[model samples]
Target: MTMSFSPQVLLSKVARERCIANIKELPKFALNDEGSKKTYASVLVPLCVVKEEVCLLYTLRSSNLKNHSGQVSFPGGKIDEGETEIDAVLRETHEEIGFNARDVEIWEKMPIIQGRNKEMIIHPIVGVLNNMNVDNLVRSVDEVEDIFTVPMKELCNIENHGHLKLQREKIILPVYTFGKYTIWGITGMITHLFLQCFLPESLYTNDFMRKKYTIGELMPSKI
Candidate 1:
């Protein structure tokens, strides 16, 4: 049977305090047990107020790019020598989305993540984009093909969430599908991490939650 999306689920709202408090005790990401030998990079997990709701910002890389062509990603790039995590994310955000450093309020530096598909240590920074107008932002023609946003409520909808399981490897990854974008790979993992802190248990649940519950009962998005 094709289960229907619940209309009674409460919408999840993004809270700065909630995010800060929730993630402190969480363990940092391991590099799939891979030893240190990867490039260092930084990406911004930008949250902005769109249409009176908190939305996540993302970019579709230009298909012409040398790496991860046409993939959906946050605004970021390799960290230059002597560059701190904040410096790299701010510079990349400005370059990719035309968001000024003054407009972004740095919130917290998330646990370190090393990409399995690529040899790179990614430092993900959570920042609040103030007075951001998606329409007014420019996408770099060279690196970014398109820029878009997804509301927190829409992302928390259980029907839109699933998993990617590797039978032989016994690996599981969270998946989120929003509109035409299918978030998987390392990007999918990052999105799941954000939702973990952004939404309450009543709204967002993932593989990490050991308790079993009906999907209908967990569908908390009003969208």
Candidate 2:
């Protein structure tokens, strides 16, 4: 079974020892198609505290990009030769958001997921941004359109959660909404996974995410 903890449990203030230790203990998994031959990539599940509440930084992809364009996503990209996932995350995030590896405290890596094209696998790493200042971030005009952070508490709200049921496959893909941004697809799945670990049953249940729906389905994703 996966270990559950409060949202505050991931706060940077108490993350050094027991909290981080427990995080590493959680169940881990990854998705890979046997012998499919795929490229590798990584994205940072960047955590930071704003006004004493834990928040996650996100980016709006530039519409100019060819893949996953004009979408909401964590900063990440294809890994360079001889580079580790940690290095790729640090490098990509730095290139996209001007976040330095020195300021990031990597906690753990969550499950792997197939990327948008099904030709690349994404490794999502959890890390805390020590004293992050969003205003100071320099976004890459060629890749990122805008950047924003959503508090963990807001994500726990039931009103903000939903799913896209794929009729043919009989699978429900998680979805979330924050202001003008609609988070679905791989990004939505990543957020769903991250939130599940932080919320106890009594605090926040993914009722909408887990419930059986008789109607309203979305076709399989193309991007």
Candidate 1 structure quality by residue, lDDT tens digits, 25-52: 5677755646547788999988887776
lDDT of 2: 0.75
Which clashing pairs does model 1 show? none
**For each candidate, what TM-score against the reference?**
0.81, 0.82
Clashes of 1: 0
lDDT of 2 by residue, 67-152 (tens): 77778899899899999999999999999999888999887887678765667788888888887888899999999999999877
Best by TM-score: 2
In candidate 2, which residue pairs get closer than 3 Å at backbone N, Cα or C atoms, i.e. clash? none
Candidate 1: where is the Cα deviation over 4 Å?
1-14, 32-36, 206-223
